[model samples]
Target: MSAHFKINKQASMLMWTLFMLMAPLSVYLMLKNKTTLIEWVLFNVSSSPIMMTIILDPAGTLFSSTVLMISANVLQFSTIYMKDDKFIDRFTVLVLMFVLSMNMLIFFPHLMILLLGWDGLGLVSFILVIYYQNPKSLAAGMITALTNRIGDVMLMLSIAWTLNQGQWNILYMWETSAFTWQSVAILLAALTKSAQMPFSSWLPAAMAAPTPVSALVYSSTLVTAGVFLLIRFYPFLSSTTWFNQTLLLIAVSTTTMAGLSAMTECDMKKIIALSTLSQLGMMMASMGLGMVNLAYFHMVTHALFKALLFICAGTLIHNHMHSQDLRWMGNITTQMPTTTSCFMLANMALCGAPFMSGFYSKDMIVESSVFYSNNLIMLTIILFTVSLTSFYTIRFSLATIWGPSNCSPFIKLQEETSLTTPMLALSLMSVISGSTLIWMMPMNQEPMTMSTTMKIMPMIMVMSGLIAAWYMNTRQIKHVPLLMLTPMMHYASCLMWFLVPLSSQFTMKVPMYISHNYLKSLDQSWLEILGGQGVMSSSFMASNSMMKTFNTKPVNYLMMSSILMLLVLATM
Candidate 1:
């Protein structure tokens, strides 16, 4: 038992060491304005060179470093979270494999070689999602796996389309007349993988996974893969105007949907998952506005705090005997001071509080986006979504960390090193990494001319969201449950505007119904009666009739036998 703990500790340390090494490399690459690509030519197909490629650009290195850092903290936290589980060692291996796949996705630029990591993420994520081995977990895993598979197919199609360009290396491919369907294909792939709009349901459903896995997968690896892909393919996809517009609509819808859903959510993990979804929308919106570097910056910064948020949430969940309902959690600050502080730090960052990591990245995204576009309605929706972010963040904080306790009177909570250590480590990053990365990375720092009103509008929106959420929370404290006040609105928001059913059950209903009817009419009835069973029954009746004839006429049978013997003797 002790050996397993040591193994996890060692693994976490090793990952942290790698993160330290990569972080400096990323900074150096960014400072030098150099991209290192090491390619091994394996073979050739006609004119195109088939090679294994590793790209060490600042973006790749920084993203990899972020992934490693978050994964290390998650692994350390998992040591406590899964301590009672008998297969902790097995869990560690799965996590390591998940990290490996994400690194592969990051460092490789070729579409063909990238599939190794792409498919690996989808496959491993499904395994992790269903790690608990229950019906709900299995269903969640299926939805996650199937939704990701859509992206996998689109990625494969993009690779095939790029084959015509004489190479699969996306780094060297310049936008030309030849770049058409591949851009759309890649966009679809990114959309599905990032859980945008119609594909958004699976993100919340995937909360069925263990908390450590959620921290790693949601914060840096699996969900962010789509955003990373677009950043890589932005040079090509940006030329298509329809792609940008389409993405803008999808991003706005997703952001609104996730924010509303989170406001109504009670489950602690799902709320965090929805918030992650909403953040992904912001990233996509940046991409839609042609701010790839800003999107990338947000992606890296978002990874830091979101991972911390999940770790803190996991600690609370672990101590609460795994009850994730926010209703049962309140006044946690008094019992676990260290954890509650870290939790609020993460939430502050998430809400884009001044000087927090989220403010450095998210504020820029909103400001730059509003400056870039002239569409008032779209901008309005995006601003509203930003407010929604703060709304849910405050609503969640009040319900769980600061609300009155609904648990047993004798419930006890304590901060363990295994839990607090990772939380503290991530909490530090959540505070500083955003500002640090924004300075270090050579992201587009274009000057924007905006009115004073425009400059503070995002902050204003955020404050309004906080006030509204506080009002709602106080009303809930005084009166009936939130569900009772507005049942229909709560229901729609909880279901993500019916997206859950539309994406999952609705999509499957028609096909599954058809299959069920086929089974009943063909396999069970017609095929059984007319195919195998009918043949057998007919043959059996014929044999029985012949047997009855033989039994009823023994003399005739003997005569026939004698005749047969005579004929056999004559032939011989």
Candidate 2:
């Protein structure tokens, strides 16, 4: 084995060990109803000691454990997925730093301390997103970096705003008149990080990263950081008058947008990336409905299966000679039973199939929506989004796993032991993690009673979605009526409501135009006339005039000197 592989193996094992320890610790903390805050005085300002605070609560510990678990599996998977890369060591280091940043965010409740992790994630994710070292990856990385930097800036602004309260600790924060602005800042930060509408183009773009990195980024780290931050700030944000309603609108729009985008998407990784965006919207919706704990529950459960899904996708892509196009894949079930089985499990969880990890959390969130008392339109959209989730997920599974093979016949598909190890480990979690967390976490303390129709509404939507997906697959796009499915509509859906252009080109267009005008009016015109060229030309003209005067007569030179001296004396 190569030294890089050895290092990755060791790191994976270390992460697994930490995960094992933290899992039990979180359970113990939750069962005992305990929260331990470890504080060290970093410094004092105006007699207000700024302490480095690490809170070991059920939420923080459990989140940290999940991060460690996913990071460990991802690192192990990378050993196979990235085995041939020359800079595996650097990749390993970046992965470790990403995990460290997430853990830092989880444990630190203080806004000031949390910025360390927040900024670290943005910087590290930019590097990772551009890991492939290509023009497309570079463009993707730029979008990812710039979008995330908006969140980082918002977070920093929130921290600065909170400074007026004499404390940066979220635990100590209470609602005040000035807190509405702080809440807006925090919400914007979360929205950007979570890839909510108007800020969501970056998540799909970030698929330019390696598959292992995508698994980590989409599942547990960079993308989810926004949801996690909001979970921490729920207490303060829930009190804000406009927060929940505005979030609900954005969440609904985002979920619908992602679903439409995923349904039309052909690239396997981008489809999965859109699904992550969809789930993030649901998490935000849960928060909007005042179900913070359930939102966290969904986040945790989503992480388990999402990581599994990406790992399996990576295996498929690797075995297919790095082809991520879904239409080119099919009928690999017989060739790779273990991988297909694991992939189906993750898919089932994603679709909220019966008793799966996603079911426990997603079902509850859907059921809880009945109690939200939001407008009929928003509620209907939420349910529609749920069905859309199943629709696209089933569509992806059908295209990649059961659809006709469109690629060369010679492509051999097999699961390597190195790849299978992490898949199996995460597959087990995908199967049982939801139940395990439900028992351990205090997400729901009482049973929910609802009408029979209300209880089965989500499953009905799931089945309808499944049927719709099957129908859509069976019918060719050309066969569909132009009125129902126009090329423009198709293009719009595939491009995510034209957000791809809006985010990249449109975002830059205004600024570029302003800069262009500035260049014309200032740099090229006014500045040329009034700055360097103007100064040089004016000086030349004055020198020529002086030479002419001097050459004409020494008396002219005396007049010029007397005029200059008189001006100096006037100023004095």
Candidate 3:
């Protein structure tokens, strides 16, 4: 290893050690005391009313604990995954800043104070996404940054609006009649961070970053930041029924699109990214349903399993000489037993398989949606989404584990402690975190007794999804043609219902066009006319008038000067 790497590695380890130690203590403190602590008073701003209001609430502390847990393990995994890269130290530094920013966001109860961490997340994430310094990476970074900047602007506007609310701490605001509009802005900000529909293009593009960054981004940091914000804002949002309804609409649409596209995506990382998007939508929907704890529970549990899934995918891609295309891979179950086991387990948990970490939160979400719903259209969409989610999960496993092997001879995956240990840590959570978290943060005062139909619907959908995926992606079904056989259907599905083209590529051009117009008209023509050019033209006219008088006679010049002086004196 390079001499530089050791120093950077030690620094990274030290930083994560501090964060890891704090996470558990925060969770423990929250569980022990039903109250929250807001300390770390670093001078408050009089004008902006910003202060260091670091909250130690159950929701915030628990989410921060999850962030640090996943981040610490991802860092450990990166040491092995990125050991060969020359820029490993730079990656390590960006990751340190990345996790630090999320933690800052986690603890800050003041909206104004949290904006610092919000922008820090955007800046560090852009740098990380483009770390490779390649054309594709740069483009991806631009998309990710610009998309996230939407949330930043929304939050900024909310902060400005909150300035009029007398108190800067949103946690203390029990009544929000005057600031209902600002609350909408906060929800939209969370939507953008979580990459809900219309803003969903950025998450898949963010796979351009190193696998470790992707692992951290989708697992606990960037993608879940919105849900974390919404969870904290739950009390205030209860009054904003319109905002909740709008959020639910956007959330379900995002979930639907991600689910459909995931089943067709061949890129291993992109499928995972899409799945993360879908789950974020679920949490967002839960927020709309007024089940903030359920959303938080799902967010925490999903983080554990998803982080493990990404680590396994990263290792598989690395050992396969950095190919992320699932079509070019298969039957790794026989070759890399440990990674395959982790991958399958993670996927199963993602599908909310019985008693899994995902099942604990997800099944509750499903059952609650049915009991809590009257709109047949919304309920139908939710049920279909559950099935779609299951289908994608099964398809991911089959494509990478049971489908035809289409590559050259495989290289042995590293069986080192660094490589497998983190996955093992998370795999344990994937199996048990759901029940543990449900106990710690239950959905209701007592057990929620759901009807048989509500309970059986998810199982039926999951079973159908499994059967369909096996029918299509199964090695034994080699002779059976897939249902999405036509080129047009495949094209639509693979392009993510053409949302990327509409949202990321084409929608991005609108800003470019506006910027170009601003440069030409506002900066060039208008400013020049009013300021520099206007002064120069006036001076030139004056000079020409003086020269004309000089060419004529002294009397004419005297008369003109007298007339000009008289006009100026009259105006005054």
For TM-score, the strongest prediction is 1
lDDT of 2 at 336: 87
Query: By descending lDDT, how would the candidates be arranged?
Result: 1, 2, 3
List runs of model 1 lying over 4 Å from the truth: 174-178, 476-486, 529-541, 551-572
* Tens-digit lDDT track of model 2 for 333-418: 78889998999999999999988999999988888887546688988988898888888888888887787878899887878887
**lDDT to native, each model:** 0.89, 0.89, 0.82
Candidate closest to the true structure, highest lDDT: 1
Q: Can you write out model 1's per-residue Cα lDDT over 1-572, one digit (the tens) per residue?
A: 99999889998998999998998998899988799999998999887899999999999998999999999999999999999988898899899999999999999999999999999999999999999999999999999999999999989888877776788898778665557778878988988889998899999999999999999999899999999999998877777768888888899889988988888889999999999999999999888887788889889889999999999899989988988999998898788999889989999999899999999889998898778755788899989998999988998888778789899887778788989988898889889988888778886587999999999999999999999888877873565445436778778888988999999999999999999999999999999989989989987897578667776577866886697689889999
Candidate with more favorable, higher lDDT: 1 or 3: 1
Residue 343, model 1: lDDT of 89
Candidate 2 yields a Cα-based lDDT of 0.89
As for TM-score, the candidate ahead, 1 or 2, is 1
> Which segments of model 2 are wrong by more than 4 Å?
476-484, 517-572
